[model samples]
Target chain A: MNLSPQQQKIIEIVPQGAPSIVEESLFEVRKKIYPRAVTGLFARWRWGMVIFTQLLFYGLCWVPWNDRQAVLFNIVERKFYLFGLVLWPQDVFYLAILLIISAFSLFLFTAVAGRLWCGFACPQTVYTEVFLWIERVFEGDRGARMKLDSGDMSQVKLLRKGGKVLTWALLAAWTGFTFVGYFTPIHELWGEVWNFRLGPWESFWLCFYSAFTYLNAGHMREQVCKYMCPYARFQGVMFDPDTLVITYDTERGDPRGSRKKGIDPRSEGKGDCVDCQICVQVCPTGIDIRDGLQYECIGCAACIDACDQVMEKMNYPKGLIRYSTENALSQHWGWREILRHVVRPRVLIYMGILSIVVSAFLFGLLTKSSLQVNVIRDRGIMGREVEGGLIENVFRLQVMNVSEHYQFYAVKVEGLPGIKLASDHVIELPAESSRVFTFEVRADPESGKPGSNPISFEIESLLGDAEAHEKATFFIPR
Target chain B: MQKWMWILWPSFIIAGVAEGIFFSLVNPQELYFLGDPVHYSAIATYSIGFLAFWMVCACSSFLTWSLQRPAGEVNARG
Candidate 1:
């Protein structure tokens, strides 16, 4: 083969061992990150959060209350049980308020200290940490795991990989089971699992959630935060100069290079950083903090802990990497000044609104009525003339006994002269159940001049102080 | 790849919230589609509703993202 002069020159420029140019794809395949495990205050905090959250998630469903799951969203029964409180479809306003509170709390927390939810508490991070721990038990830590992955497919490698995968699968399955348990009666669901009698939908959800947990935490890891989290994309907008963020003290740590310990770095014209790269090794997201803050940081503070240990060993003051605000980092402010800046106007507004909403939410929960009555006028039927020359109206009443006891309720109709219940005025209702009944109310035709008269149904529970007043319009022929 | 993520992920989150709100107010047992009663159970209805909302939201997001692309790229692709 004859080579052109240009090709010859290219070959000459490229050394014999150097490979030819490789075309890059539009989508970059991820290089796997093997974060070394570290132990420090923040790492312990992360583990603490993992235990607390998982306890709530995996244990809460088994807790019994009123002969049922304490915190169940029983779609089968069309009721949400939160301990003593039962929320029906009509009480969905509470769900909206709950969502609003969540959104506001996110904003408040983000403004105060960035990605606190994502770092220590997020299911994604916590689950990943757990899966990594399991991985460590089988394959070993960062260096060994990396070497094993890079090495030949030996029997040991296969066994370790298989064991890790099996453990992860069991944990993921357990997680998925717990998730489905929230919407179904866990006791019954557990029996169904043992008997192989799980419903199709139940099986589908269990598998779906298992796959989700496995893929998201075990495989995807930081990719979810970097590429897929909606909060990650919008969190920049939530941040101000005073917002506390995981920071690298570039001013203090610049001219970073290695030196012998106990030797003053100033004389050597070097900074506190030993260039050991432990901070980079410990990073889950695999970014150097010295390049300044990036969106990829989940604020996990593994780098901070890693660097602090290095600083301590080097006999220097700690906090080479620390939680600090942009303003504080730039202005070289002390902790006092940083705290003062954190109380900026934006933070105050967030805190103020958060307190208000929290109080309101508590108030709503505390004062929630135990009875619900919906007076829906039956449009299918109109006011009719009964045998006594009286005007009669029909209403479809949906009354819910939101409490935990069977009770008798008396229905009274008013808002017209001598208006009275024409049908059975007393209804027997069971605990936490709703019933639809056709209520008949009659009024003297000459009670008032009326086309559509406003009326109210006064429902009083005979067993307790629970009562409901619902309004409906009664029509009279002109 | 990233463009797809930008469209899908935000819409996915939004769709989840929408499903929660919609199902909370309208019980799946009582839901009717185009004057036809939904025969599926509450769990099935909820799942389908979430998927349908997600599809709608993803379409909206994809359209918005495609429209905002550089005019040269859009025209060249066309």
Candidate 2:
């Protein structure tokens, strides 16, 4: 490829003598990134997602469902309650389906646009942005922060660093509390924390989570996204030429040179770029976008805002750097044409699978039963002869009430003549509780001739108005 | 080498004891020993196992510190 004079100049001006390629040496220290703040449409959109995701994550733990915490995954109780759905261990397949659905959705979105989740909605980016904002408030903007970090440790520096650390610690602690709130009841957990009555395990986990949040978000920051995150490594597999990414338009911005305002740069054989490095200054990863797309770029579009502002000041059209596909940038295709190719067969298939999985999940949730029953026959003994000429078999019945209200279940046995319950037919079961009862089934000796007989046990809840039936075989001596 | 191993060995023993304790607390039904009449022996065995696991992890720190000497030498030369 033949580069234009402007391209040659840009190639020349980009920090000479630094290693332009990545190396495998493990001991290399990372350079600090001091990204200047910028405001634009995409920036606003990123902030909106930050607020939405954080609110849902932090707020959902406090929402009450029935008399218990909503969205609780009680591993100890072996139950997951989400809104009105009570998922027992047997329903774990639904979680697998949910994960598949989420994966397919990610694939579909990545096919359309590259790294949108990483730029906006990822926990690392969102929480890091929040922690940076706090740091900015306590210390100052990028320049002030750089100066403070390099200067001697004075009282002012101490106060600023102390305030920032304290704020970060408080946020990390609150995040940990909210996370534990999903497993333990938030209100009760709060009481325990306030009274210092937390159990050993709870205290350990709270401290562990808080430390992790503090280290990852406040200190590690972009290092986590760059080196530690698996997504950065795997994102290449999801990207295609049609996937939209933030790119610099090298063609229009060639023959670059600095010029005064209102000067005809193109007439003077110069490009419209004016050789301003605003884009590089505003990048969060400290990489020059003009060097082409690198894995370090999270596609936050801060460079686009910075470049557009520079273009506006120079009285030129904006989008010297903008979100564009490789094909569109190289071939100058219209957005609608690019969008048409974005919904290709691969993306459509992913979308179709995601929709089916989501529909199946919703259908399962809507039609789920509020009652369940399990019957276990005693293995120690076979059928026995009672004094009343009734053959008896011992069985244990576990009746679970999944409804919001208490239920009285009437147990009934069928498929044999003269079948009777050993105790009262009705058993009171509390809401969200399972009760195990050992009962005897009595039937005539001639019900089946010296072999196993198929029997059905049915439990009907009066409060929930639901019925559950379980089938088991009653053994007879041959 | 001998000094490093000595520094590492105690941490390994402690880590093993900690892991055993954790597992027994999580699933108490899994612990068993042959010819152990008293249950106290089982408890003591679990405690020792957990302490050994913790010690193993902690002992690895000495190994890491020893390995860093080469990197430090390289930086000093540079």
Candidate 3:
């Protein structure tokens, strides 16, 4: 390898043992962050949410409904059962609507209180909190964990580290099992687990999901929030000046200096902040809140709690760091002023759109037809001349009963004159089941002209007030 | 090279082993040996599916790496 003149000059100027040009390329080495545990109003609220969300997730899969799981998305059967409502493949639009609603809700929330979902309800945040709790239980607090890592490898260290990993693995495995149980019936899946008879896909998903949970929640932690989350990247666009963010009041907190207890900060030309870095220590993403709002902040409000506690101890007013809008902080406005701006144009628009979408979604779901009929013209032979000078069109009808009870449907064909069904007009369908049946439609030979004729199939459920109408092209030979 | 290996090779091996375990357990005979002895077409389909899986894993791994990397930021002193 020959070095260019520029490379030689660069090497000469650069110090020895420092990162070389090639080594100092784009990729940066990762330094592990040990977040200290803090207890405050926001921390308690986060724990409360963690408990509520985890309980709901782990409990939902076990609850039985109509002798089966209450919320099962049986992909193999291509049916999604939600309580009393059974959504067939044809009802996939409802799922799309649900996703749209979620996205809009996120937009509304971000416009109001920035990153509340990331802080409170996101699965990554929730699982990481749970895993951290488990780790704390096994290997003391943040300081202890850091010391254990820095100290030489020892018996006690191994035991504590091993215990943490084992606990994390168990929790991850249970989470994975519950995830798979959604697609497969939990009770049946449990029986399979006991008998060691899980099918290949089931076992694969179980291990894959478990490994992912373990690696992500236990090891990856805030890294999942910082780089992997697209929402974190795009959330800035949704933010406004009036959006409530976890902020440090630089005006009140700057000119910060270390002072003894009972020393008036104002008299000493110092701000309320006592120069304690508790806020940074408690921060999950390892960013200082005093440096202004950064994109890495999940807005968990841990810094608020930590700062408030320090203020209380120092007899200073609270909210040295608190949730305030950028506009409020800049304008020196009180809480009432900030609340007034919360209902600004952007918020109102989002709320209006969200409400309309939600209402329409509800209306669509409530008025969902129980009967689904799809008519497919046989491609191989479009139309044939059967005996008796009649034109016959072979068609396949896919009838799906989206209800929970057996229903008989009567099928009728109408379009051109003398168009009649050649097979059984009335068919029985099992609950939440779909079947494809091939039947022939015959039209009078002299009634229709050559080319494709428009025809319609009317399926009326005999069991309920549910019916469906589907149109298909009926071809006729010249 | 060592640093790159630390990120790439371990992840590659883990993904490969995981895929092997899944395939061996699932035994997707239909995907790889449909109606006949194992043919090149069947192998091609199976390989394509595996390639798709690896691509997804690579994307996720890259995201994780980028997030954890230290950006040479100087810590603020108050």
TM-score of candidate 3 relative to the true fold: 0.78
For candidate 1, lDDT tens digit of each residue in B1-78? 678876887888899889887777777888788899999877788888888999999999999988877766778989
The collision pairs in model 1 are: none
Badly placed stretches (over 4 Å) of model 2 are A1-23, A75-78, A387-390, A417-422, A445-450, A476-478, B1-78
Q: Provide the overall lDDT of each model, using Cα atoms, as 2-decimal numbers.
A: 0.89, 0.79, 0.83
* lDDT by residue (tens digit), candidate 2, A1-478: 8988877755355666876665454323677777677788887888899899999989998888777788887644556788877776667677767778878877877777888888899888889888888888998888899999999999999999999999999999999998888767789889999999987667766896789799888877777767666578688788888889899898898888898899998788888887777788777777789888898888788888888889988899999898899999988987888878887777778788888899999898777788888899988868888877778899999888777788888889988886777778888888778889888888888877777999999888766478988998777665
Give the range of the ten consecutive residues with the poorest summed lDDT in model 1 chain B.
B66-75
Candidate 1: C-alpha lDDT: 0.89
Q: Taking the tens digit of each residue's C-alpha lDDT, what string does model 3 give over A361-458?
A: 99998888888888888999988998888899999999888778889988899999999999999999898788998889999867777989998998
Q: lDDT tens digits, residues B16-64, model 3?
A: 6565445434434444345575544323434555666666666666777
* DockQ winner, 1 or 3: 1
> What's the lDDT for residue A14 in model 2?
68
TM-scores for the candidates: 0.87, 0.80, 0.78
Model 1, C-alpha of B22: deviation from truth (Å): 3.0
| Decoy 1 TM-score against native | 0.87
Q: Compute the interface RMSD for each candidate structure.
A: 2.6, 10.2, 11.1
